[model samples]
Target: MAQRSPLDLPEGDPFGPDNLPYGVFTTSDAPHLRKIGVRYGAHVLDAGAAAATAASPHAELLGASSLNPLMAAGRPVWQAVRAELRDWLTNPAHRHAIEPLMHPLTTLALHLPIEVADYVDFFASEHHASNAGKIFRPDGDALTPNWKHMPIGYHGRAGTVLVSGSPIVRPHGQRLPPAEAPASPAPASAAPTPAAPSPSASSAPPRPVFGPSLRLDFEAEVAFVVGAPSPLNTPLPLAGFHDHVFGVCLLNDWSARDIQSWEYRPLGPFLGKSFATSLAAWITPLDALAAARTAPPARDVPPLPYLDDAAAEPGGFDLRIEVAVNGHTVSRPPFSAMYWTAAQQLAHLTVNGASLRTGDVFASGTVSGPRPDELGCLLELTWGGRDPLHLPHGTRTFLEDGDEVTLTAWAPGPDGVRIGMGEVTGHVVPAAS
Candidate 1:
């Protein structure tokens, strides 16, 4: 009896013919040479080789070392290439030519799929933002004034965006000391007490001290990859989202909560967030997730005309995400719970005439839901460290050296199948001296 083919996957495999995510990989025999590959069940097909074997017109695009060139080719080309690849895999006539190009996934080393141009992260989840505001400012409003009016985002350091499995060096930075307790109220002896004098320089609040961050955390997010470039000073509307975006992937936006808390006032995130961000190697194409599209949550405030997506296609993805630490599942953030949709984010990002690049990446900030188990990051799960999470290994308020965090997700796919977004994982190492 002959052994079953790797392509003959079990029913309902997340990575089926309906979901052919792309990535870059290398083999031990030629570690220096990188090639674009498409995942198929337990194997990765050398896409370029298969295209070359089939004498495909898009062979050059498929054969590139990086996904940038193909992604820059625009939407029509993307659809055509995807159609051809699917036909080659599903059609028995091309199986003989394609099967030889399939390589075992375990034997390959995956790499960053694209050359990142610019990275932006958005605070898109209402639950997450509310939780954060409540944790950091107990006496203030949970959501900011302009939060519902538009998508709040900040530019991130693209150079630090790394592929999954990379080691994260805990960042070093200044952190404010714990707040001093209020002095007991003086006895009500005087009818009217004079106001205390303003604090002098010598009596100023405690100064920040430099050290390794004590509150390391991970934010589970989903990100979109840009495909086509746009002209400078031209705005892309919400309807143009699919025209420019190529695919989606899982993202782990690593953060130093202590460093952020000390420096985030007045200005937004700086060194605390610029250290490291992990991206999954596999990028599931937008076309593969057609079944996952769903209506976004109803907005409490009416959106501005430019960001309005009321008449657009369902702008939210029904992705179910799982966040784990050291092999223990902790949170299950639902992508569908995000208050702001990806289309709205794209429109808001380009509304000011900012251009789009082929490899530009923008992530949905910390996907979280209303349930206790649905929080995306340690900052919320541990409730600002007041409540420690009791994992099987031990209790944890935040990440420790050698701790590994992984994020994985799946969306509904065509014909009741599931579309896998793969996973982004990183291990924390001690900070540098």
Candidate 2:
């Protein structure tokens, strides 16, 4: 766990800070996927090939080829492989085991971390809730009647989730303002001016306009990868939630804010959330992050019995998370302030026996806090951009076309080597003309 030197990295640094996560990769010249690999520096230490030669319990998971077989083998196998991999890569002289299959991370391409079975996005951050409340009901309350009762979430479309680096096409949808107040005719006593046609009658058709949204937005969050499958009616104890999660990744839940505000009242986010979502390619194993876990803040009201985990650990990861527009890091503060924890959400998810499968994604919602600078999204950081945020490139209330958003996170640990989650980025394309 000590910080590795740059030389260790160049010798195919398997323990590089940003490369702590794992994912399948294939080089352009490789025929038919045949190995598993972990990102380190700019190289991938081919896990599959290394296991073939190394004497480790993980050899079975790395058998012959593609990572899909290993990934589907579930959590126990993943943990075994992670342990073996860390040992093989960290020892300076282990190249005899890893040399032949090694390749630069840049030359290879990342694949979808998993074949996601389902996706659920949770609104578990209190700061995010309060900020939204200020916009929707500024005059009254922050927490809703049902908010403190349980974590609120919506099932998301898994088919639409894409890996980092994929281009996001602008989504087209209907947009409209509230109906205008009716106009009144001039008073007879005023000797009315020439009569005018009714404004409403002369307006354009009311059908949905087809063009990319003008108010596209992004939600920065942490996602849990479900490793173990569950039965349809079994409830998982709050403390046991960790057993089912494989690892974690950074995610950007893209949104069409304008459309969301208009349509969410009836049932909640649909198209606004359905278009696209991008996730960090590498997945940081949960075991590696377990050492960094810290306690979350207490809720004012007592949680429902099933929702409470009396034995739950008091801390979450101490990761420093940030967002960058195009390539410029935003002025907002880091991610230490999130009010909700992923464990609580997962525990509640199966309270009724809802089956969970490997590859299911659960997002932490937008992480924000009391500090104005720590706000997670433009809607909060800018107070609706009533005040624009200054960036090295300029200032922005929200994203603009050709703009790219990137998210990165890291935590300091033993030695000089810090574990990190690589960047997840996406660019804004112009709306259809």
Candidate 3:
């Protein structure tokens, strides 16, 4: 069936002609092999066939099961593929041959777009940082001394990067009990032995526990993917950020507050964060986000010389990110409100001459706004477990077993149009025995 006219799409069609994102997919007919495709109205166009029909040399590159080959081809090939993909969807002459190649998203499965070479998560949001300082260390100043000087980030575990819809097993780790709670918690796996009936035996306090995390949480964030590689000792200037970065997507850096607070005191995140990180499949090219760019929030302290270049334009994206738990809307974080821009983060990352690989993935720290409801995670929204959030089902201090969390986002396009970032969702199940 050929598309007779301009395809009549839904009111808020995510894959309209203007927003053609790329990802790997597998259909019911071809479950064994994966193929790359560009998104359209409720359908995915075979990028390989589209490239072949356009008589482009990149056709063979697009036929690969992964986007890494095309990504390594750099700016020129990426631009050409984007142009050809848009033409195939809009050009009426190619309708009949192309229609058969397109597959509905409902009948297909989307996988991770790029095989991540490395992973990093940053603490770039001042609002989020301020809240943390106040909640954890109310006596000292909220802003740390060197926080304004540069972007703060740490390397994360890339081996555990999972695609959307994957089950997130509730991680079990050692955690400290609250001050007011029992002195010690019984072992999770061991059955409690009966103590003496004497008064002293009954009054003895319990010991610390090892069980599933009591304060599991979710962080709503945005991350950028590196398509163009850079050599060691060759820093990426702020002006050349777009040249190195291929595109942006949504990320969920799941957290366990109890494990983090106890372990992050001397260093940074460990088992608390490395257990799992979720990402959306589609990779929205930077060129398609022209209208979504905006200026970074006002800076109280100017950045270092190499991190900010005056010639480079303001570069924050106007993407609205949302977090939902079990189908109920809880927090709506404004991605545009981030204090540090993606370019600044990219420049700071490589300022020390760290070379970038083809599929390096780094995330913007949790996005939070000035409003109370703008908080990105339960730790902030509930004031470090001081205030419990009241939901339709019940009140929640932290994520409970069986709760599912999802992160989704959208950006502005031309003529009142909007583009979407495919959602990343994961369900929390019981921890290991």
lDDT: worst 10-residue window of model 2: 182-191
Task: Give residue 350's error in model 3 in angstroms.
Answer: 0.5
Model 1, 228-329: lDDT tens digits are 989888998888999999999999999887777656644678788899999999999999999999998998799999988898899999999999999999
Q: On residues 111-225, what C-alpha lDDT tens digit does candidate 3 reach at each position? A: 8888999998988888888877676556667767877888888888998888888888888887776752322221100111222234465575534567778888888889899
- Candidate 2 Cα errors over 4 Å, as ranges: 1-7, 10-19, 31-35, 55-57, 63-74, 178-208, 331-334, 392-394, 415-417
lDDT of 2 at 37: 66
Locate the minimum summed-lDDT window of 10 residues in model 3. 184-193
Best by TM-score: 1
Error of 2 at 257 (Å): 0.4
Clash number for every model?
Answer: 0, 16, 4
Flag the better candidate by TM-score, 1 or 3.
Answer: 1
Per-residue accuracy of model 2 over 1-433 as CA lDDT, tens digit each: 8743422666323356334577777778874574566776766777766777885666766653434455556777877677777677767687555655667666887777677889998887777787776654556576677777888888889999988887776787755443521121111010112223345866854444545665677778888888778888988877776678888888888887655544454467777778898988888877767656777776687888877755677536667778888777663534556556677788788887898887889988777767776767777766654677787777777677888888888765555456777678888877656
Candidate lDDT scores, in order, read: 0.88, 0.69, 0.81
Model 1 segments more than 4 A misplaced: 178-202
Candidate 1 at 271: error in angstroms? Answer: 0.6
lDDT of 2: 0.69
